[model samples]
Target chain A: MYGIRHLHLRNPGSWSPFEELERLQASLERGGVALGGASAGPAIDVWNEGDGLRLRALVPGVKPEDLEITVEGDALTIRGTTAVAGPQSGDRWLLRERASAKFARTLQLPFAVEADAVKARVANGVLEMELPRSAAEKPRRIPIQTT
Target chain B: MNCEMKNGCATVAEPTVAKATPACDVWEGEDGVHVVAEMPGVDAAAVEITIERDVLSIRGKACLPRASSRAEGEMDAVATGYVRAFHLTDTADAGAIQASCKDGLVRLLVPRKQPAQRKIAVSTG
Candidate 1:
């Protein structure tokens, strides 16, 4: 059976529900805060394949040439910037909820991976990456000897 | 925190329902009104746009890849479905609406209908 698993590693130390609530309340009290400044990391999804892992990230408005990916040992890092269109002279922004800024995310793999075998592709603003396991990490069986 | 046993392994409780409202930007230009929606992980073929009367609805489903092995550790998962709707004004020409999806972004164009101008004749009595 094909199974899919996700690994979520968020900065727990810096985030709290109470703090988020307080910030929301403060923004409401101040009428409205200016958009931007806050850099929330993009959403990412990881899949644990038998011999490798797959990662998908949402990066709308980001060009393929702007993305940079690196894999070293068990750490995989992705960095990119989303272009923000300049406002036209006569145009007024009614709403601006989509985030636009330079963002970086690094994920720690559960096991070592083959850096050379990694492949990545971007389509429709989503980035997909495949990381293969190292030769030594493949499962092996040992035979018992009876004396 | 809630936990459940799935396939003999204890797993964190996951929200069964996916309720993701995609972010959107609406603006009017000299040509027409434009609506841009950000829907990540959604393919161009999976996007569905429908217009009924004055209501315009957009729906998209993301087909995330599957893994062969069970996953461990804690990770946040993105919603796979997106939905949003907008109301069109009387000046909007629904028949001329056009939509395009690219790089996980969907753009819709709604052209405005021009009102006919008439010159009234003035009679001097």
Candidate 2:
């Protein structure tokens, strides 16, 4: 391991031991609180696959009816919400860690994607969007005759 | 001492806010069990739904983006609230539960477990 001074320079965001412990405790406490107060969970991972770009989002509990996908040029916007179901009930719960509220995530594509040919599917709590490259944007090859 | 004794019960028994019971519609058919939740503003990514032993639990947060003044002039779409729940039920299949969100409605399909197969022997006639 590098010296403490060198390590601190390399990782500017590194906190002291006390600070780290405090942060850990804060996170645990936050998790124990009611759902809405905690931070957003995971972020979507996107990649470019030679011929096209594939975007995958981990949207676990949302229903098919509560999601909407919109693409404007290279920017994609996913908007939707899950409704709280059930009547008011009187009960006492020791702990509640799930968040119940609305949220939206938007992303700008790095490369130009064929907006018309894009396809999306949600299965097993994952949303996958496949965006193919436009004909004009795809790589072209030239064939030469043997001299 | 007298005031403490008189209000001890009152202090311990603070009136609790009546928690609202989430309204959902559940349907069971040969295909699977379908559950529809009416959450308005929650995002699909923020929602966590699980089915264990036939009990379905859905939890997620909703954060509506602040509308820009320019966009307000162009469009009139309003976002509402969030969606969270721990549904305790035996009607749904715990092993094969599928969920999706669209617009403001959440639809869940929990397929029942398949039955075991029995071996059948055929004798030459």
Candidate 3:
């Protein structure tokens, strides 16, 4: 129940929009939930709940002091860069496969999030962020008076 | 192959995972270089980090238990293994390499051999 809720699908010119949307919908339905296509960025997971929306991005090798999180209107953007200093003079390698560069991703929320209450934390290599729901968006209970 | 080094260093083989690629924090002090890599689902014994001269190599397999348990189903969010490698410089000391694994992270320390100091004798002709 506590997993990705939306996944954004792009046309990518290989498939029609209708076909893409249908596949996306089917995948979500088959999984017993949905994450709209607009949420799947590199190393990222997006979800929603009664509280509002949450986004988690896995960015290893990056320090918390190096990240930047920003929200404007319905869009949320995360950006950061990682750098590795050169090694010693005699180290040789057989195979090297790891990504290192600047990264940026933007996402749209299903409902308006209280931007003021959004929070982010980086542990290990995962970046977790939570956006609270607006006061007006929260559920309210009405009083019933017996006549 | 064109080895055009970028970022003020000689280029090695380019990495394949272009976007959102996993990286490691490398610290080079007077004695050694410390490398901390994020390798989720990988065990301490399973990982192997090697350095020869100036090239540093990292290779491992991350396996998820019960990954093949389900025979028939939608098979959503299946776990898979990962293998990554890197080429480093010769300054990394191969003899004092130390590594540790914690919470799916692998930390490696490669010490550098200090150059021996020698004095030259001057003969007056």
List DockQ, one per candidate, in order.
Answer: 0.20, 0.02, 0.05
Q: Summarize candidate 1's per-residue lDDT along A1-147 as a digit string, tens digits.
A: 011111122223334669668856643442221234534446676777657888877787788998989998888878888775533667545445566677776677877889899999988788888889977787889899999
DockQ top scorer: 1
Error of 3 at A88 (Å): 4.3
Give the CA lDDT, 0 to 100, for residue B93 in model 2. Answer: 47
The residue ranges of model 2 lying beyond 4 angstroms of the native Cα positions read A1-42, A84-88, A140-147, B1-125
For all candidates listed, what's the TM-score of chain B alone?
A: 0.73, 0.56, 0.62
Count of clashing residue pairs in every prediction: 6, 40, 36
- Tens-digit lDDT track of model 2 for B70-121: 3211111222333233333343346667888764456776565565689999
Q: Tell how far residue A137 is off in model 3, in angstroms.
A: 3.1
Best-matching candidate per TM-score: 1
Model 1 Cα shift for residue B73 (angstroms): 5.6
Write candidate 3's Cα lDDT for B1-125 as tens digits: 11122221322233442111134555444455565666644567767665544455565454432322344222222223333334444444466678886545677765665657899999999
**Over the stretch B1-125, how does candidate 1's per-residue lDDT look in tens digits?**
01111221211222443635677766566666677788877788989887766557777887665455536432344567776666566677778888988878888777777777999999999
lDDT (10s digit) by residue, model 3, range A28-119: 45322113322232355566544666665655456778788888756777777654434457543222334455666666665667778998
TM-scores, one per candidate: 0.72, 0.39, 0.46
Candidate 1 residue A44 Cα shift, in angstroms, is: 1.1
